[model samples]
Target: MASTQQSRILRVGLLQDGRILEERHLRRPGDLTVGRDAKSTLVLPLSEDLPARFTVFEYRANQYNLVFSAGMKGRVHLGSSDVDFEALRADGMAMQRGHQYVLPLQESARGLVELDGDLSLFFQFVPPPPAAEKPQLPPDLRGGLWRTMDRVFFGILAASLLLHFSGAAIIIASEPPPEPELSLDELPDRFARVLIPPKPEEPKPRAAETAQAAAATEEKPQSNDAQDKPAEATRPANAQEAAARRAEVVKKVEGKGLLKILGSSGSGGGGAFADVLGGSTGGGEIAAALAGAGGVGIATEASVGATGPRGGGTGNVAGIGELGTSGAGKVDLGSSKKEVEVSGRVTSSTPEVESSDVDREALARYVKVRLKAIQNCYEKELKRNPSLKGKVMVRFSILPSGRTGDIEIEENTLGNDAVGSCIRTVIRSWVFPFKPDDEVPVAYPFVFSPAG
Candidate 1:
């Protein structure tokens, strides 16, 4: 019975201020310690009065012993009797040397040991807990892949793989042979025409016709009437015929109401108007006088005839010659040449950093790389006003995530609101390569000018 009790395990429990903290089962021949130290078997809350470590229970000579250190207060229960540490020391039942007392503990002994009146340790011998059973799957459910997988599914998968490989092999082996390559020289004419077409032949000039055309162009300045009129009406054989034609045209003009109308106005107004009309007897002379007076003129030359009155004149003059036979000539109203268009250039200067954590060189490099995008903002506005050229200073902050925020135009000598707004929008999209510990303030300036 003594040997059987020695074989049983000792159960030790720790209490803090009378509240149970933890319990542990110790086998025979094993020692137990309790203290605030981490290596102790039973650890307790740290206290100035408590020692770093103290052996509370010891197993020796096939028997368990209880140890009481100095300042420790407790009672030991043996069977139906109780013995205090002081009583044990007085009766010499417990061995005492210096500041510690040892009492042999029986299998049925159980008691509480207090440390500084704050911590208590309970100890006793008890049966050990039952051994845990090993986990296992049921016999019907346990097996390898053959028993677990569907046999029909596995067979179908194998058949499908075999058919796929067989079809691929048949198609590859039965493919048609390759055609022979042909040289460019041996190719058909149709292909030759498609690949290398013949150059078109330029028309050759006729020397006689060209010479006559050059002489005609040089002799007479090109006129719209000359181009529109019949060859016979455009050129007369001799001066006599030309003079005869001019007299005929004058006679025809006088036959109309033009002279009578002018004479009637002159007769009423008198002055130079009457004298000029009254003195002009011949229609040719009158037409010349009207021409010199900045009025309607009749051409005596065979190529052109009478024309409409100059300035603002009211009268329907009949027998005014053919449609393309009369006109002073073509007058240049304005130039057809285009005005030169100019573009403006946009550039940025080095950025000014106002942060201790952000790297100046890195910030400048990032700004330089994205400077083109910023410049694009100004250049878009610069296109509208070529003279748009000035400095724009932008203020912004780099967040901890390296993204820009609070972007605003601090100074815009450029004086264009659209440009400033565009710059702000562009800067807001910029993200630096580095993340800052805190937000960093930055100022950047840009200059714009028309490209020379």
Candidate 2:
């Protein structure tokens, strides 16, 4: 191998959520799944109060796999709990054991491996637990001892079941909420009326004056029954008929939640602002929506173009601006006058490290494994035979530490170390997906057949 380093090492790793990853290259996957093996350094919990399933398979003992989600290509600021599984690759500062990485829910989350130098790729997921003896109960227990234990266990289980169902029933039988009790006794002024004295009135001026007075003293209702009586005299009324008329008025404000906010007297900016919230499943009333906005007080069209802070037209604006062939084209949204800046970055879709806190049954993780790339070495062996066609099979173990353990020729239509070594290099360079385990990290065999 010409370019093979003697005592040098390269490492990569990946960590994904609770999911299984199996040894899969462009070859034999067998019973395990071929997970998304991109290189990402940071891994996070599924949620605050849950275990995260992760895999960390390795192609070599020193390296790891990295997996990244979409659009995580910037200065990732994971404050405290953000999981940096491959903190071993920390570049800038020394990683103390007590430090924490908190990942706030971002618009687009990223999985990145921060190493001394940037890596071209990384993946997530590691192997399952290594084989271990299963714990079992002793077989020598006799008669009453076992029977008593069984009975006690059954009793406790039954009690728990009964309690669960009883609680559910109690919740189901809860009564509906009582209706809001209405009382006219302490009702607010908005729902009340007053009386006023009769006065000589002119048709043109008095009619305007009536509305003006109502609009003026509208803020605080007319508490004077005398003043209220005069205002009432101007209105057409009869005792029974007036009661009916009030009912009609009440009906006018029904169905719609119309709130009228009346401001104070002369030049007090008194006005009625109605809030009519529309039910979903239909178009909304623009006027109602506008009323909700402080855009209530009307500005006459004459002053419309003169009062803008931008020294432009007074019409309201929201999203985009003028579509023109480039004159005073678009609104110079504050930042437009500044120089336009361009940005660039590099991202690997591989998984880097996974959280070991929650071990999943079927997820996988990886370790760094370097494949011996013997460039052009295969040409010598193949040229000697001249009949070396088709693929040669190679079998190897993708160590839990992400290194290539065992390597042997599985099949060879025309075998050579050059042929087998090529497959070995690929298997070593590539990552086999695996799940994370809390007890013991498992080891699995990885197989590959090189392209002819």
Candidate 3:
């Protein structure tokens, strides 16, 4: 009973006459010792004649028990012990230690415990009030929720500011870019535009005046110089002489083996031959006449009479080849003549070793390999500016000694000069097949492209 009583709460009240004088809510019932001592639950005045430690009250099942020690000095009275109060007021009581006093019959009442003379302490009994049912928040939890809301609000604000700044920076950086400047090599179109002048507009002529001028020119009399002269006409005697002179010219022409007549013109002819053999004749006219007459040789026989020391006739004209003209001094015009050999000189301007004579696959392979080494230049330039992509046409000459020279940048779409120069330097260091006859010119194209 004592162990169970020590765990429950006890409410003690001290009252005098009717009203409460003092109240205490006790958590530890075992530690409650009322006395004149300073550490007791209810310390009385030293002159009260109470024990150094007085009585204690313990709680059980919603009721309180007053327990007194054997050494208690005061006489603690029970409910309405010496009072003739009303029946309702005769409720609470007090007792000596080592003796248990049940509470008063009434729900609330007081007892007078006499000390000395008229001085006494009154004890009261009262039940604890019902606990309230309203819900409440702890201080720690409320403060934590407020702190969390504050952090979330600040985080959202910071995020919004960062996004706003980022978008602004993007807009600022995205302004229209500057237009590209023209390169030095791009001046050809400008030069052509400036240099080529527009054709002059001609003045329109009056149609009536142009027609009158044409009619006047047509009405003018034509001159006939050939009919005005009689000496220009050919006669039989002059025709014979003209034939002899034409024969001499044919002999010299045949001697060079350049032209050959197919057939003989009749030596005694008198019509077209008469005109051909007449005085007025030119090299072009004679050729035309001979071609028309079928006089060019084709297996016809003729004899060439050579003048020996005795001046004797070597052969008759009829026995000579057809190429030999029938004349007093007959010569063999069909005989083969030796052409002079002019060594060490190229008569034609064309290269002795043309592109067809070169091994194109081998040359292409070599160039492909060299292109890899030279690519470093454009690679570095493209690294700096990836937009660079174009063609480069390099024209270079391979000397007869197999060394590359006369390197030229025929076309370069790349804006940088260093790229072309670097490529030229690499090409100059290249060696090719030795050609003693002619220098080989190589035209190579390079295309540069950057990867995405």
Candidate 4:
């Protein structure tokens, strides 16, 4: 399981529990030196030791090419007697920083090996056990051409590296002062306020008050004249009303009990009736009433005419006297049509919405189920690393109908990728309880991080 660039020592029990963790293999350079901080020589329990001495080369895609010596053959380094490595792993907990890798068994053989970390090579996977059958190749591709390029290619590579190193040294020596470090303290304060002029105070309003006072003074004289004119008009209105009342009294005396009136003639409901109010009399009734009458009253009009010889005295004394005599007059009657009026009342109504339309209890139950589903995933990570702490904010889609939709990364948020990756992988596998409408995905950004 271990190799060197020059030689290899295939040790048994390199990965005793079928796992090699890089974190478990890390050690301070000082810790590697003997005797200063050494632990007591206590035998380890049923656990393989981490590699005490090793050289690590990182390869792409989560692979490592490790090499180490077999000087302590058949004896592996002791695990930290203080810790339980198995429980930490089983719970998905991270080991300590100094604990990177584990080696279960070591082989004593020292030779050149091209062993793979994976199935085939570094950045590749190796089989758990060797293949029993040998592989065959086609005859045409089995030529010696692949072997010839190794030496020439390596020689050219070495020469180019040497030239590059010489050029880099020359550039470094020629430079003078080091560039200034980037700091916010060195930059100007962009948020500083700029200078501005003070605003002028508003003017007082004495002039407007003076103008209003002068206008009020001018209106006083005009109001006095208007009052004096109304006093003069009151006397004439009193005289005209008295004359009309006398005529109304005479008419009431003549028509008292002979005719009944519909309404009073005065404005306050007590004056005599002004219009003719009796119905037409029948001929037979009027004749019978006249038979009892001893005398009948008759009216007559006489015509006066003057002949030329009859010595007509100048009866027309003046032009003004004849004008006052009676003459035929034209008259007008008004407003014959009746007026029509419309009337109705107004009322209001409300919309058909109600609060009980949505089922609140069902919604609350669904929310609880979702929260529990998410909490279960967090417990898995905590069990693995009790010391692990972080908050991860993930922006993923929940469909309008409540199904899981797109899963995406929410950038610029708190999270540990080691923990986040596992959580995300497991959450995408869950099934939701409801179907969403419109299939429109809504993003929920959930966060998890260290409590501190």
TM-score of each: 0.34, 0.14, 0.22, 0.17
* TM-score, predicted candidate 4 vs. hidden true structure: 0.17
| Model 2: ten consecutive residues of lowest lDDT | 26-35
lDDT of each: 0.77, 0.39, 0.57, 0.39
Estimate, for each residue in 139-217, the C-alpha lDDT of model 2 and write its tens digit.
6653465566777788899999999999999989998789888787676665664333356677576687888888878
* Candidate 1 residue lDDT tens string, 1-452: 46766567888888877778898877546889977899999888878878899898877777778888646679989779988888888899989868788898877888988876667888877887776698888988778889989999999999999999999999999968899899988899999999898999998899999999999998676575677677756687899988788778866776467565554434334533355544333323554655445545554433122433333354554444534655588888777786566566777777888877787788877778777776777668776877788999989999999799798889999889998898888888887877878888999888888786
Residue-pair clashes per prediction, in order, are 0, 110, 20, 44
- Runs of candidate 4 exceeding 4 Å displacement: 1-367, 370-373, 383-387, 400-402, 411-414, 430-434, 445-452
So what's the TM-score on candidate 1?
0.34
lDDT of the structure predicted as candidate 1? 0.77
Better of 1 and 3 by lDDT: 1
Per-candidate alpha-carbon RMSD to the true structure: 20.1, 49.7, 30.8, 34.6
Q: Which model is ahead, 1 or 4, in terms of lDDT?
A: 1
- Which residue runs of candidate 1 sit more than 4 Å off their true CA positions? 6-87, 91-102, 106-342
Ten contiguous residues minimizing lDDT sum, candidate 1:
302-311
lDDT ranking of the models? 1, 3, 4, 2
lDDT of 3 by residue, 1-452 (tens): 34433444455555445556566766544445666789887765566466687555554455555454333234333454534222212343343223444332233334545444444455543344556688868876666654767787888999999999999999999978898887767667768667786788999999999999998777654335545455555443677798777777776775353243322343434333433344222323444555556544432123121332123434343322535555587688978888533211101111222455455566676676566666776776776676777777778877777788698998888787888999888888888765545677777777777655
List the candidate numbers ranked by TM-score, top first.
Answer: 1, 3, 4, 2
